[model samples]
Target: MTSYDPQKIIDIHAHLHSDLPSDPALRVKALESLLVEQGLVDPAAIDAWIDLYAEEIGPKRGAHVVARAWTDPAFKAKLLADGTAAIREFDYQGHATGHLIAVENTDTVHNVVVCTLCSCYPFSLLGMSPGWYKAAEYRARVVREPRAVLKEFGVALGEEVEIRVWDSTSELRYLVVPQRPEGTDGLDAAALAALVTRNSMIGTDLLKARA
Candidate 1:
């Protein structure tokens, strides 16, 4: 069996042309064909990965976890204390989430996650990793100039707010618990969940109170 290599996936994408088909489905199919044609990855490996993200899990799981933490102080305490165990409350304990750690965005601190070596993402929780997340530029730049990168993503933090970048590995992954948006005091968990964006959970985008 040919083992899947997340780093190789990045390398393969780096070699793909910028002018790939615009249609999302066709774009994925084109990439798959190119990788298979180049003998860089096996078709089954690609399909298995696609099925894992497309059918089994997504960012909604992470959003609900964040929403729960926002509402339940006890669960928030447990989550900050032991993320892997706390997420099991929602049956979000498997594979990429086995050794999860939750970091909070507070008044003085903000957290962002990156896999400097490869795209070692908690996809089972965060869904398919974004293309930029898997890019070499992001992996290298986010660690060195995090504040600048955050700004580029439209997340401008004051100098007083410390930005911490967490590196993910196969054995461990991170989840950013973004601060609850103001004016959401009456929102239920589901309503709050609907407000959570994947980028907000990734710390690239800040959550704003709905108007």
Candidate 2:
């Protein structure tokens, strides 16, 4: 048998590799498989941990913040003025949430969030970024045509309302505080939290009146 140089093989293969997996989820799954194969971690353990963060801990944390802001004027004022400190009030802190900025949506103005450079999101609060959120098209088009992108997501704004797009960076992360839905005045904080949606928090969707 003849010996082949590994570097030479890799070089040839590199040329053939034109593009990467466009779907971030696919790429993540592939990487996870590789790690599992290498015995660096167990797949079941990784899934359980992810589920805990995504389902149990993630959106619920942000929902609580929104609920409090909706019900408590003082906390809402503090949250808008200083998101990082206000969020810490709930004992939610992580490296991913370094500098948090809460943008409030009102009758006159609406806020949307995006990461143009990369998928830099407040994972601690929002959990995993949606696949569409990490798409190149979204990253590029949302900043340029926010209204159109929002419309596609079934969120249409009035002509009088101003749309402000916040680009998240490594230094700061933004969370959209969606306006409280009408007819929810009687709802308590826990009930209000239940009405909060992940997309509303991301500014891609609006909070509808829950029956």
- TM-scores for candidates 1 onward, in order: 0.77, 0.80
Write the residue-wise lDDT of candidate 2 on 104-203 in tens digits.
9999999999999989888878888899999998999999999999999999999999999998866799999999999998999999999999989989
Global fold similarity of model 1 (TM-score):
0.77
Cα lDDT tens digits, model 1, 1-211, are 6559989877777776465656899988877788899999898986798887787688899999999999999999999999999999998787688888999999999999999998888877888889999999899999999998999999999999999999885678899999999999999999999889998888899998788
For every candidate in turn, the CA RMSD to the true structure comes to: 6.1, 5.8
How much does candidate 2 score in TM-score?
0.80
Cα misplacement distance, residue 183 of candidate 2 (Å): 0.8
Worst 10 residues of 2 by lDDT: 13-22
